[model samples]
Target chain A: TQLLEQSPQFLSIQEGENLTVYCNSSSVFSSLQWYRQEPGEGPVLLVTVVTGGEVKKLKRLTFQFGDARKDSSLHITAAQTGDTGLYLCAQTFYGGSQGNLIFGKGTKLSVKP
Target chain B: EAGVAQSPRYKIIEKRQSVAFWCNPISGHATLYWYQQILGQGPKLLIQFQNNGVVDDSQLPKDRFSAERLKGVDSTLKIQPAKLEDSAVYLCASRQWTSGGPGGNEQFFGPGTRLTVL
Candidate 1:
């Protein structure tokens, strides 16, 4: 199984605090994606980093993929209440032909306003 | 320009009862996926379809669960004689398509159907 392990299952911080979440796995992946999901809604894509040692930014959020393509990280600078939600990382596994994504148990973040 | 859509935003049923959920992917999307999400857990893929054809169902519980994407647009997922463990949110997502065979394709998800079994 291509399992992705996420760190800091739950985080609570005051407004304007910076935070970083990590996702790691033993197996290599072809691509990695980060998603943010709110209550009662489905996940929305934040970014996808396909290359090793790649970085993508979405406004105040920054995402990075490991050099081995086996890990990724999400960082939020000056996180506001609007930035609170579940952060998920999914990786596309490469096998024979088509690939499938395996998601990790998300990091639940709560930013106190 | 619409996102994925799902019906029965919430359903409460007793154990052993049967229920079905419907999903309509974004118009013109060829790939559709069904996923199950339990509390405090990430969504797990139950089945995947590409234009009315089954692409992957390795994680689906075949004995009591089934799904289909007929005509390559809307789809249905059914659970017969459901177990309490089956309670969760069922999410539908559509894969993005482009000229490069969907590289960097990000899935668009629906609000999801929340099923509660008593």
Candidate 2:
């Protein structure tokens, strides 16, 4: 019964602005994955954080996993119009052999040019 | 390499009608997955197959929904007497089994089939 709660369900920001979206859970996870899904397309993986307090950057985007493994965050330093999409966080709990993912509701972002 | 492929990019049906969608996984991939993504929500795993064998389908609504992976390659999912809440984008994904387990592998996704139940 692990659940992922994401904050700021919808965000509208101007181009070049910065923002951070959060994913929190009450249960500890073995790993966390970030994905970006555009309209009419399936989600594409952005990054995976396996270590506590680990941070990974993909260009202008930065992803961090909480030290307790109960939370994660995605920060965009300077978002562009192309970065507008729904951001999702998925968790892989320990002892899950099939690697099934339980995803958060997601944060929809719109970047105005 | 080619990615996963799904057919009928869009389908519109009235409630109580039947519909089916097809998916072809990436060549040599041993794992395939089907997911349902409601609007404003993340994708939910509907079923998972490991080389044509069902691995997990706990969340699938078996009463009116069915899926099959044939020959460990192509797959199909169907809904009979669909409900209005069934409207969502169905996505197909595939992954090659590796030593680190399925969780460590990356999944390649298809464009998804948008189902609209009116």
Candidate 3:
């Protein structure tokens, strides 16, 4: 079984501040995905990084895959209250045509206005 | 496109009782997944189905939990003799596997059914 660990389980920030969350694992995954979840709702897909050292941008949010494909990061610039939610990083592995997802503990971000 | 749908957004049951949750994945999606999310933790894969065939259920507590995807569309999860630890949000997701380009493996999630065992 593969496991992903995320740092700073809970974070509280002021508006316009910047923060970064990290996901690390000893086992390499074929791909990694980032998600943002709000209270009383399921998570929404933010991005997926497949290649090592790959970088993807979604507005102020920037995601980076580690050079070893065993870790990933999420950086948010000029954070706003709307950005307050749980950020989850999950590693997906497929044995064949079937896929199984492994999720980290998740980092809960609270941006105070 | 409509997202995955789950019924009974909330459920409250007593310990040692029985409860069931329903899920309807997005149309044309061949894969469906059920996850269990405990408080302050990420969701854990409970079961996975590929067109009504079981894929991986290693993490599922089969002792009392059982899930099935009938007709390769809708699915249901049932728990008998529930325990206090059974209280958690159940999430349903669907995805279609693509040959390449990240494999289109992203799982789209439903609103989730929150279960409370008192």
Highest-scoring model, lDDT: 3
C-alpha lDDT values of all predictions: 0.89, 0.90, 0.91
DockQ score for model 2: 0.58
- Evaluate residue A19 in candidate 1 and report its C-alpha lDDT on the 0 to 100 scale: 98
Clash pairs, model 3 backbone: none
For candidate 1, the TM-score of chain A alone versus the native chain A is 0.94
Q: Sort by DockQ, best first: what order? A: 3, 2, 1
Put down candidate 1 lDDT per residue, B1-118, tens digits, no spaces.
8889999999999999999999999998888889999999998988888789998899999999999887989999999989999999999999854223224567889999999999
Best-first order by TM-score: 2, 3, 1
Off by over 4 Å in 3: B98-103
DockQ of each: 0.56, 0.58, 0.60
Candidate 1 local lDDT, residue B30 = 84
lDDT string for model 1 (A10-44, tens) is 99999999999999999886788889999999999
TM-score of chain B of 1: 0.94
Model 3, span B8-41: residue lDDT tens? 8999999999999999999998889999999999
Better of 1 and 2 by TM-score: 2
Q: What share of the true interface contacts does each candidate keep?
A: 0.54, 0.55, 0.59
